[model samples]
Target: MKKILIVEDEKDLAENLRDLLEALGYVVVKVFDQAQFVLEYLKTEAVDLILMDVMIKGSMDGIKLTEEIKKSHPIPVVFITAFSDQGVLERISKGKYEGYLLKPFSLQALKSAVFLALNKHAILEKDLEGASKNSLKIRDKGYVVPVSQDDILFVEADGLYSKIVTIQKTYVLRGILKEISKNLDPKKFVRVHKSFTININQVTSLNAKELVIGEHIIPIRRGFYKSLLGLIKLN
Candidate 1:
């Protein structure tokens, strides 16, 4: 069974979420309104996912707490926020959360978000575990080619398809950029734009706007520059 942690301030809502998740076969742990308690619990236990409320009781809000937790634990977090203000949305976008649910969400919506978040996290974890020997399998004209992950410099979205660029060649795969990115190792690849995911190990230079992998210059989307910077060391 997958373990899930709920960080909501409302006792009633938290209980409801716990009941719903538990009924769906997940082991749920509820932490009502305490950011410190959540952090402390994480130190002694492991969970597959976290359902975080935006305005929990603490000096650090959900977005800030999520950022802090991600610095040490890469556990996927799905924000459950009632606020839809521009400020809140912008802040949430800047954070490293997997998904979000707005106020008064339906049961089905909650189910779908949690399921997708957990599923995406599972794919990422699987890819990370296989990072040492995993190769992206691509179908060519008649044969399937195995492209080693380390050899990939970047992946670019081409409408419905994605172009996987390696050191020597590029292959087109029939999948959208978002779907393809979830299967890549997050530690090795970062989505710098809506249309580009690049290998950090292969980056030669980077600035506020773009990054270079060998001879190719990949544009960094507005909000993604910070994400890319977080993966690298600075002087």
Candidate 2:
């Protein structure tokens, strides 16, 4: 069962929602009217979903609270608002909620929206885990090989596959260059060429046209040269 937090100013409506969620085999962790209280509670509590009201009787609105929560950690938020004005809709869109429901929503709609939000949130977490470079698992032949971030020398793009070059050997994996580049640690890996992402720690020499990492000579595109040089110089 997933835990849910309800942030609504209307006490009667909050109770109704709690009862509905409880009946649907979901846990209602807390019903908070103010944003600060919710934030304070979350310091020690874990919740899977948040049902938030767009307008609340407090200093901080639901959108602002969600923004603050996202900076530290991301939780699926579903906005429930009575206001149907253009301004309210605009604010809801800016919040980027997984789902939204108008006032006096049906039980079926609420259930579907909540289920979709939770399912999507789970998928997002799996994608983040896959993209993270902290002890990445790469499929090498028939074995799943674990590679540390510090062990990588550079990544070179082959037509549709990517080559992970280490001090020992090179491994070919099925992935695009651009997607592979985004998964690497930005501080350690720098894209000198359109088809190559070089580990700064492995780079021994650099110039306007190319950069040398160990024995490999990687070409640096003219478009990426100036900005890359400037960024390195500033650092």
Candidate 3:
């Protein structure tokens, strides 16, 4: 079930909405009268969707609160406000809202809005999941070793075999450099030299022709030097 957050100043209306949402089979994680409360809550918990009333307590209205929430958490939002004020509607139009429900809306109308918002959110979450497949299983000996792309520090092409180095240990598997690198994320792992491939995250420091990871000093080949430096953004 999709988790929803209700931000409404009206106590009775908030409870009614919560009950209605629960009846519809969606999980109402919590309700807040103030936008500030929601901000604090979001710090610890993850919400799938937000049902925000346009008008609320505190200086930050629902729209502005949504903007703040979006800076870090880009979740789907549905506006459930009583007033269709021109200014509020304009702001809502510019905001990342999936649906808008006018006050005095029927339970069916509420259901439609929430259902659509969560459906859109579900698709987005699915896409995100597909993009974050940053892990690989290494066929080491009879057993298999699972490793995260981010955890891998470097790989050295050792003739017929490749040496995989992680934060903790190193494994020499029977594979060529090109074959072994196909399992890693291309964006995070790059060939710095003919024999060395380093993870972008593992670079501790770099100079004109070399990068250091842990105690290993990987040389930057003349052919790959410029491209290697361009890929890494050092502070």
Candidate 4:
């Protein structure tokens, strides 16, 4: 199920919204009169979207909170309000909200807004994943080579640099394994060990402790053994 965080000051309305969204099959976490608390939860909790109210009783208004959240979180936000003044619309637009619902909105309107926002978020995420999978450029004034994720059979960390092994070629990079792992698609690539990140699709065979790709052997860390199997099956 997709998780959502609802931030509104009105208690009765918030409860009603929670029930309505829950009935629509969305897991909703509602916050009343506390934008700061919602912001903190967003840092650690996994939420797919946010429902924000413009006017609220808090240290920071909803507009500020929305701006801050958008900078760091990948989740989409929908602004809900009964007031439809020009200034409010300007502020909401400035936040780049996925959708906006004027006050006294119907249940159907709310449902439709949430549905479209989620669809847009999904599209954006897929585009980002595709872009990351297609290219990995050097981060610094080093030999910047664009390595296709498909061409990379595996990556082995050598100090601060990683040695990328492909089906027909190999290259060295001046970044750590964790740094490279961020740009790799989780569906296709996985970190099998602290020192190695392997493309699960390229893996020819796997043992209890090592993955065999042609003549090369990549060690699978004890803690990541189950995850490795999951990735292999996923790919």
Task: Rank by TM-score, highest first.
Answer: 4, 2, 3, 1
Q: By how many angstroms RMSD does model 1 differ from the true structure?
A: 18.0
* TM-score of model number 1: 0.57
- Candidate 4 residue-wise lDDT at 37: 88
Error of model 3, residue 122, in angstroms = 1.4
Per-residue alpha-carbon lDDT of model 1 for 1-235, expressed as tens digits?
A: 8889999999999999988898888888656587898888889889889999999997978889899899899899999988999999999998788899998998899899999998898898888667535678788887878788889989999999999999989899999999988878788888888899988988877888998888999898887677678796533
Every candidate's lDDT: 0.88, 0.86, 0.87, 0.83
After superposition, the stretches of candidate 1 with alpha carbons farther than 4 Å from their true spots are 133-235
Name the candidate, 1 or 4, with the larger lDDT value: 1
The C-alpha stretches of model 4 lying farther than 4 A from their native spots are 137-173, 176-235
Of 1 and 2, which scores higher on lDDT?
A: 1
| lDDT tens readout by residue for model 2, 158-224 | 9899999988888898898898888788888887777898787776777889877789888998877
Task: Kindly report which residue pairs in candidate 4 clash with one another.
Answer: 81-103, 82-103
Q: What digit string (tens of lDDT, one per residue) describes model 3 on residues 1-235?
A: 8899999999999999999999999999999989879999999999889999989999989999989998889889999898887987899999788899999999999999988888887898888676557766677777777777788899999999999899888888888998888878888999878898889877878887889998999998876666777888764
Please say which candidate is ahead in TM-score: 3 or 4. Answer: 4
